[model samples]
Target chain A: MAQELTTQAARDMAAANGDANRRAMAFTPAVDIFENDKATVILADMPGVAADDVDVTLERQVLTLRGKVTPDAPQGYRQLSAEYQVGDYIRVFTLSDDIDQAKIKAAFKNGVLRLELPRSPKAQPRKISVKSA
Target chain B: MLQTVFSPRNNGDLFADMRRMQSAMNQLFEGTRTAGQSATFPPVNFWASQDSIVMTTELPGLTEQDIELTVKDTMLQLRGTYPEPENGDDITWHRHERVDGTFLRTVELPFRVNPDHIDARFENGVLTVDMQRPEGDKPKRIAIKSA
Candidate 1:
């Protein structure tokens, strides 16, 4: 079945209010959300973000994902042309009542973050058997 | 009865109008999708010094074995694939926005590079390629003779 995907939020660059030390940009990573019978899964693409730099937190029904991308330019080279933008990634999502918040699991590999949010038992569909007298 | 008669639209009609508005909004944002499909994948950043040129690109979900890099004259070509994750038959997707498949990005540098002196490294999904400028292409600083 085709799933309806929605972009709840967008990538916003960090505000640089005349601060010389402020970083140039911050992007919201592209994400994919999917669901199965057991759980809903979210995949976020954050290239250049190492596993150690990623932080995922759930607080009061709100889930937040943040990843920092360290600049990896080779030593003593000055940037000449930059066709791609680079920066940290931040995004948040509100959890629904059907999600089992306590059982959420997350994994990061190859700069892709995978989150699994299991469904509550009550939310799962059950087959009912009718009795014939 | 008076309110119903004077109402601008019914609930069903209102919902249909909202659906229409949503689709129209989506159409407005369709340009973002096409913009990303242009000739670049794993978009790159380039740097130049007196003797060398450096380039870097982001390649998430890829490994060293999945990529091929080639440099000839002043042109550098990168080819790679980001394989999709395996899922069971019962899975249902709610959203899929990331680009997945084979991609090739070729960039032309301002000066020819030495093929034997090129260096490439992949770490944390980022690929950095460094190439030394050819001896003939390097800028020569001539010493001024005292008159």
Candidate 2:
């Protein structure tokens, strides 16, 4: 089914840790998560982030996603109005033990990031066979 | 600032909580959706110089072929469709926040722009359109004489 799109202003990341120095503004990217029998997938929307600038790292049970974006205001132009601000994207996810950390894969295309986390073989459900003598 | 709130196993769905917060925010800013407001899908920002106007919007997961742009006098029209991802019945969504649908919007510029002088580019999922003012429409300065 096709649904109409709605505009939402980007939310600025709060300084919970009280960091003194921050070079650029950071916004949490909207994401979607899904799971099947084999794997769980995540999709994030981060516009203006180049493929080379995306960073995804899993340390212990935490998965971190970071994308840097260069300020895109055109030179020699005065800003008339702004509905959205361009900024870096950051979001973190805590993975479960069912996920296979070694087999996780990620791909970035058209400013969207797709992450695939395969379920660990030890955690997969298997059917038990019965033998009748 | 450190923000980490994606809990797939323990917290159920964080996107649902976010949606709840977003709906509350939407209620707080209820009057933003007034008539003639172009604040629809793919929010845009505008810039202007002495003789040109630049328009930009962010549209992730879309290519050049997916977008259509047309300029007629002072009206600029943008139309596009975001294709849905291919998924089988076996897949079940835990949190579906990313949107996929068709969008069409027409914006009226401050002044008429020549269609021939317009340039558009799609880079890193952001579309930028640069339009130069028509030569006949430029303001002419008058020289003052002193006696």
The most accurate candidate by DockQ is 2
- What lDDT is reached at residue B86 by model 2? 51
lDDT of 1 by residue, A98-131 (tens): 7878898999887889898898877655579999
Residue runs of model 2 more than 4 Å from their true location after superposition: A1-13, A16-23, A124-133, B1-39
lDDT of 2 at A24: 64
**What DockQ does candidate 1 score?**
0.53
Question: Model 2: how many Å of interface RMSD?
Answer: 1.0
Give the alpha-carbon lDDT of every model.
Answer: 0.78, 0.82
In candidate 1, stretches whose alpha carbon ends up further than 4 angstroms from where it belongs are A1-21, A122-133, B1-36, B85-88, B135-137
lDDT of 2 at A108: 92
* Candidate 1, B54-129: lDDT as tens digits: 8998887788999999999988888988787657888876667777888887889878999999999887778888
In candidate 2 chain B, what residue range of length 10 has the lowest lDDT sum?
B1-10
Query: RMSD of each candidate?
Result: 14.4, 14.3
What TM-score does prediction 1 earn?
0.74
